[model samples]
Target: MEAWKEKFVSWFATSGRMNRAAFVKRFFGVNLVCMAAVLVIGSRVIEETGSVFASNLVSGVLAALAAVFLYSPMVRRLHDIGRDARLAQAYLCFGIPQGFLLGKVAALPPGSLGLYAFEAALAAVTLLFIVLVFHAGEPRRNAYGAVPGRAAAAQQTGRKKGRRLKKAGTV
Candidate 1:
């Protein structure tokens, strides 16, 4: 239980590299949960309130919370992919409108200029995110932190051994 708490904290509270496999697993897992929540809880709120403002409000709040929760991991994943971490900001830029427009997207006219722009931006960011999930992370230590997984353990063990040797003046 303690170990799991530490792992969760490391992923959510810090900006550090996250390899492709871990990123895909975590990202998709969170998305699935959030989507389910939105569908269930948001719908419940709408059903109770029977108002557009209430539904939109719930969606917007959930979207913002999801974005905030995902920010660190998303940035870390981008770092692992050798991309600028700030790319995560694009998620924030699109998230609100995506939430607010969730129901209205279907009604948007095909030729609406704003709709095209929003769709294009959303598509581009989504494509980039997919590529990040599939692309292998850097194999060695990077600016963000040590390599993850087994390679990281090996690197860290070697470093610890070196440090011990240096401390004993046996290098």
Candidate 2:
């Protein structure tokens, strides 16, 4: 648990490198947790207020916060791959507009063009996110920082050896 907290803190830090393994692990794990929270809280909000809008309001705020947690890691991951972090701007370009438009289109009747447009924009943003998450990081360190996997492995191995030596009454 303490290690997870430390990892989460680093995930939000801007000055670091994140390899593909780190990115994928954080992305999937964090997203699954966020999704579950949204489902539970959004449903409860809707049930309490009898308003889908109320639920959306609560969930949208939560989602936005989750996106912040996601964004820093993505930027670092791109940095690890020798790509500029600014590439994330493309996601914002599509995502921001889609976010606002989605709420408006939610009340639209079925088969509405506005809804279709929203879907299209959402699809594009999702695709970009998928590509970034799956893209391989540089095999060696680039300008950004050291490779995360190697550093983490070394750290873990050292900790394990220390624990063994401690148990043997050797510091």
- TM-scores, all candidates, are 0.78, 0.72
Tens-digit per-residue lDDT, 52-143, candidate 2: 88877766766666666677777887788788877666665554344335567878998988778778877876776777777777778778
lDDT of each: 0.77, 0.75
Model 1 RMSD in Å is: 3.8
Deviation from native of the Cα of residue 162 in model 1, angstroms: 9.9
Model 1 ranges with Cα > 4 A deviation: 1-8, 155-171
Candidate 1: how many backbone clashes?
0
| lDDT of model 1, residue 92 | 71
CA lDDT, candidate 2, residue 140 = 80
> Predicted candidate 2: what Cα RMSD to the true structure?
5.3
Ten consecutive residues with minimal summed lDDT in candidate 1? 95-104
Give the clashing residue pairs of candidate 1, or none: none
List per-candidate RMSD values in Å.
Answer: 3.8, 5.3
The sequence of per-residue lDDT tens digits that candidate 1 reaches over residues 108-143 is: 888888778878887987887788877888887788
